[model samples]
Target: MEKVRVLIVDDSILVQQILTQMLDADPLIEVVGVAGDPYEARELIKKLHPDVLTLDVEMPKMNGISFLKNLMRLHPMPVVMISTLTERGADITLQALELGAIDFVTKPKVDLSNTLDKYEFEICRKVKQAARVKRESLAEQYQRFAHNQTQKPAVESFPTTKVMPKLSADAVIKKIAVPSKFPKTQQKVIAIGASTGGTEAIKEILMRLPENTPPIVISQHIPAAFSEPFAKRMDTITPMKVIHAQARQKLETGHVYIAPGNRHLIVEREGTQYFATLNDGPEVNRHKPSVDVMFRSVAQACGPNAVGILLTGMGADGAQGLLEMQQVGAHTIAQDKLSSVVWGMPGEAVNLGAADQIIALDKIPRTLLEVLTLLN
Candidate 1:
């Protein structure tokens, strides 16, 4: 098999060197070239024609964001962000994702050499996943983001308007099936788990939901400083009230509780009332706010009243927990392989016989809504 060719683009020669060594260590990855800045990166991109590009956030001549926007508009492909762990870096990384990045690997917070090896496995894995991303899917996302970035917004809504995809729910849903289990005495709560490509996937599903939709709890693998902004971003576009998970907030219809960064979001029920909590314990599957943690928690807390939906991602973090949810009579669904940027998580769930339905990304909302309507 041909190795996944990569180009490292960073202002720091040191980071570029370190990344080159680390990425080259993997037999499946080949660092074809390295560029000091976007200008050089552009030239190298045209020449090398690499499968993946690793980009830094801060650059000398043009910032990574500006270059990213331009690149998406001109020539789109899979790009992975290599970012610092600072607050500002976190925000920029999220912006890159919205701008059409496939995934990111956070730089060492401190003791660079010591911690660099810690992410060696992760960096290589992400690059491999990125190389597999369907170019058409990324191209479409870039077209959407680039189109919105340049257009002028209406005066009144300009302050808060976001560029959401124009795709309709009917375009993706093959068939909507109601849960076989009828409504129990308790209300049903939806639990969603995603990583990698999930940020946009979640946005698409939630934005399609009605204001009267069922309550939702999400475990989206995100960095420490990006979760709140993600929730705020979703809130601005979707009618559903999106909030970072609070210690004791009760789950309510039409509201979404997103797991805060660096913590796991879990649901616990006392009688009919379901509440969300943050778990600061050890990371499961190398992710805080792990889908496995949240899914397992939901299985114990909501049981038959829970509905699990696993979306696009690159790891098996949520697969086992989803199986547990299915075993307990909770309806479980996984995003179909074709629509996913990286289908690892959902594919694993389907492989484990965890999903009652395997649906397309756009169809998730309609299928979910159909499930809710079937219940009490």
Candidate 2:
């Protein structure tokens, strides 16, 4: 098999050397070239045509975000951001992902030795995953990129009133029905699993829920340092209490538990009560905090009392587990393609007959509420 070619773009020679050493240790990856800044990266891109690029957020000639915008417009490719672990870095990294970078790794604030020791394995894995992403053409990406860039400035300058799209009652009613075999009891727990476009999607659903919503357990694909802040941001806006799942924390109504990034969160029944179990299990579906792990556990522990929601993501990570839930009499819902950023996960569940109701994004929360009411 051919090796995955990579280009390292960082101003620091020490970082370039360390990244080259770490990535070269992996037999499947090949370090094709290195660049000190975006100008150098442009030259390397023309010459080497690497499968992946490891980029630094801050560089002398041009900042990473500006470079990223141009790169996506002119020559879109899989780029993994190397960012510092600061609030500003987190905000920029999130923006980078939204702008089309495959993923990001938090740079160590301390010495090289400490950073490498902590992040070597993670960095290597992200490089491999980044290599697999399919990028859009310069023209196609640029059209959207330019539109987004101009839209914000235009909106701020003109201050035109924009209408919010509302979901019709008929559209909402179509997705509110419970499955024929849905258990006639309160669905006290909801287990949600999503990857890729989950951040914004989950926020939309959570913000729409009432303050008295049932307990929700989420397994969203995210890196280690990002989950805590993501949960905190959600908690501030939503009435529900959102936090990263901790081992042995009891599952309570109105509380939302997000699986700690890189750790699996499973549900266990202790007689009449349910609690979370955080474990360092082997990666399932190429993800540590995999949806499959959480959904399967919910199927076994909660059985008919659970509701499984599979959301927008890029892979079939939650398909099998959704099936298990359906087989065990749990009502399952998958996000419809029209509203999904990537329809892979939910599409797979629908194909496998796991989803009882396939709903549009805007209708999901309300549908969930109606289902819960009927079941109750």
Candidate 3:
């Protein structure tokens, strides 16, 4: 197979060189060209027709955000934003994603060598994934919507306030056919993994858990700076104690520990207590805080005492690990397709028979509650 072609666009020569080296180190990726600014990148794009572009947030001639807007309007393609690891950078990167950039990576200012080594795995993985992404041009999206409208059969208008009947607690509870069977007599831990549309999905699930819910270890694929604020925000709204995982922190019931964006969080058991283990190991499934690594650890440490949840994400990052959980007799649940923003991860798990229960997004919390109750 042909390697995924990539073009690097950055104002800093050092950044361009570092990123190019990191990407080229991967056998599945090839750096086609490097540009000092958008003007240079425009010329390279025309000449090389690379499959993916890695863009720096700040450039001398034209900023990445403005270039991204024009790119989406005129020639839509997969683009990943590389920004400094700062508050300002995080805001800009989020905006870039809304403007159609596939994803963002944070560049550390100090200790460049160590930081680059820490994030190189995810950066390369994002580039490869971005290459396979099917970008929708503004024109194409408009035309597709128009076609759908034309194809729909005419119907009488219905009342806007005719809300669909909500599922009752019993009805929702009955849908969780699979038993958790977790040994709640002993300490229990919940390990969750998600990516892609995970941000909103995680919030929904975490917010719904009771104040006494078991401690949760979550691995969501996201940038470093973003995870801190994301966890804090979840704490404000949720009944459970939600915060980013810190090294050596003791696992406490009713607290939700989100894995730091660029590091993996593993569970280490000591007698009757458990603690967080943060490491900079090689990326599993091309993610540092990989769901696979976390799940596998939970499988070993907690076994039947754990509840594993694989939420909406792209790719098969957590499938095998979730299967491991099932093999160990741990309860494993995956989010169903209709409620997922992108059904890649959970779909793969369901297809592979790794998931014990597949539940809709809204129903997941209730199902989890039922499972916890049964386990107790």
Candidate 4:
């Protein structure tokens, strides 16, 4: 089997060498070249033709963002950004994703040496995942997003220095599922799990849903400090109120609760009512906000009254949990392989016989609405 060729580009020679060594150590990967800046990277890209690039966000000659934009516009390829875990860095990193970068890895915020073990694991994983991304698919996404991005509501505007709003677990619960509160005993729930290309996929589902949708609990793989902005941004575009999950907050219809970054969001019940509960325990499936945790919780809490939808992502985190939901008589759906950005998660569910139905991404919202309406 041919090893995946990778090119490392960063301002620091240390970073270039360190990342090169780490990626090269992976038996499935080869370090084809290294560049100290985007200018140098541009020349090497033409020569080395590496399968993937590890790019630094901040660099001399030209910043990563500029190079990323030009690369997506002209020479589209799979690139994983190496970024710092700061507010500004998070914003740029998200922009890079929007511009068609496959994924990112954040440098340790404190004590770099102490963090290397974890960082090395993630860097290798992301590079491997990135290599699997089809360049043509990224080009399509870049074309798809370029226009819709410009017309978003001003409330969703970016780069704000203002204090991001405090999001309690149920902060936006008013008038969930409709203009009226859902009956506690009969309330239905929806659980969604996604990663990789999920940010855009989740947004599309939310944007299409009516204000009368059931209470939604989402576990999207995102870094700390990114989920808050994600929930806030989702709230602005969708009629359904979006809030970050807090411990033991009641789950209500017409509201979507996003799990806080780095914490598992679980749905639990007390008597007849459901609440969004936070699980800060050890990471499950290598993710603190693991989709499996939330899916299993929803299965236990709602049973036949729930719907589970698994979207495009890179791993199998939600596959077994979706099967749990299926065993409990819950209706389960997986995004069909044709529309998936990466078919790993949803595909696993399909193979596990977890999905009751398989549908395209654009069709998920309507299928959900129809299913919920029939149940009601």
Q: Give the best candidate by TM-score.
A: 1
The residue-by-residue lDDT of candidate 2 on 41-62, one tens digit each, is: 9999999999999999989989
Better of 1 and 3 by TM-score: 1
lDDT of 1 by residue, 1-376 (tens): 8899999999887788889999999999999999999999999989999999999999999999999988877888899999988778887888899888999989876777677788888899899989988778888888766655686322111112222122221222111233354335547899999998889888778877877777899999888777888888889867779998888788998899999979878787776788888877767777787888888878877777889999999878889889888887889999998888889999999999999999988677877767765654
Selected candidate, larger lDDT, 2 vs 3: 2
lDDT of 4: 0.81
| Number of backbone clashes in candidate 3 | 0
Error of 1 at 242 (Å): 1.5
lDDT of 4 by residue, 1-376 (tens): 7899999998777677678778888999999998988888999999999999999898887889999989987899999998888877887887787788888888866665556557887889888888887888888777766756776422221112322132222221111222122234678899999998887789878887877677999999999788887787788878889997877788887899999888888887777788998877666666768888888878777778889999999878789889888887789999998777789999999999999999998778877877776665
Mark the regions of model 1 whose C-alpha exceeds 4 Å error after superposition: 109-114, 146-186
- Ranking 1 against 2 by TM-score, winner: 1
Candidate 2 whole-model C-alpha lDDT, 0 to 1? 0.79
Ranking by lDDT: 1, 4, 2, 3
lDDT of each structure? 0.83, 0.79, 0.77, 0.81
Please give the lDDT score at residue 281 for candidate 1.
70
Off by over 4 Å in 3: 1-82, 91-102, 107-186
Which is the leading candidate under lDDT? 1
What TM-score number comes out for model 1? 0.86
lDDT (10s digit) by residue, model 3, range 1-376: 8899999999878777888889999999999999999999999999999999999988888988889877876788888888888877876776566466767778887877667767788899888877766665323433432443367422212122322132221221111223344333457888889987576577668766777778899999987888887787678757788978888888998899999988888887776688888877666676777888888778877778888899978878888778878888889999987766567888988988989899987677877766665655
Question: Candidate 1, clashing residue pairs?
Answer: none
**Location of the lowest summed lDDT over 10 successive residues in candidate 3:** 166-175
Alpha carbon deviation, residue 204, candidate 4 (Å): 2.3
RMSD of each: 8.2, 9.8, 10.8, 8.3
Give per-residue lDDT, candidate 3, residue 145: 29
